[model samples]
Target: MENLSTIERILAAKQSLPGALLPILHDIQDALGYIPPDAVPSIARALNLSRAEVHGVITYYHYFRQTPPGRHVVRVCRAEACQSVGCEALATHVQSALACEFHATSADGDLTLEAVYCLGHCAVGPNIQIDETTLHARMTPEKFDRLLAELRSKP
Candidate 1:
């Protein structure tokens, strides 16, 4: 299958590097969105590690996902700065509106909600990043709806 081919290529490309495990994992995730469960054995064999080791690395990192993400990834800042500015209420609204909890993709697969520690925009606090780009600062429930509507309106 194409996935296997891609994984093989990724492994071959990064296998020779020093301390290659993390880079290999990162590359795999970049190419496949998430490391497939089946990938653990192959990676472990290639790197001379145990499947448990590979899986442990993948599971230890918050950035690594075990499944494909939705069309959009919405990350709301939950760090102290943002919380001080009422990110909790904003978070509640997002969860309610999206009908999915943090780290989950919506049933419709249109959105993935995540809790991020910070967006480095504390001055504007209550920030949310959409799809790794487009940071919206000083967010409110109303702003979120309008933004969601705008995204949904796009073909």
Candidate 2:
């Protein structure tokens, strides 16, 4: 299958590195968009790690997704700093607007919502990182709607 071949290629490419598990996993996710459950066994075998070990690593990191992401990813800060600035309400608004919870892709597959501890913009708490860039500061329900509208309008 395509997934198997991609996983094999990733394993071969990164197996030679020191502390290769993390890099391999990251590469796998990067290449496939998500680390499919089936890839776990292959990864474990290539690295001589147990399935449990591989699964543990995947689940341990909030960034590693087992399912593919949507066209866009929205990460709302959940750290104490963001919380103090009303991130809780912001998060609720995001989930309600997207109709998806943290780590879930929207039904239309246009967006994925996730909860991140911080985006390094704590001073501007309630910030969100859209995709890999485009950090929105001082987020509120109204601003979030505009952002979502822009994302939806994108190709």
| Residues forming the 10-long window of minimal summed lDDT in candidate 1 | 25-34
Error of 2 at 19 (Å): 1.1
Clashes by residue pair, model 2 = none
Write down the worst ten-residue block by lDDT for model 2.
Answer: 117-126
lDDT of 1 at 111: 91
Q: What is the lDDT of residue 11 in candidate 1?
A: 90
**What are the TM-scores, per candidate, against the unseen true structure?**
0.94, 0.92
Off by over 4 Å in 2: none
Could you say which candidate leads in TM-score? 1
Tens-digit lDDT track for model 2 on 72-153? 8899999999999999998999999999888889999999998888788889888999887788899999999998999899
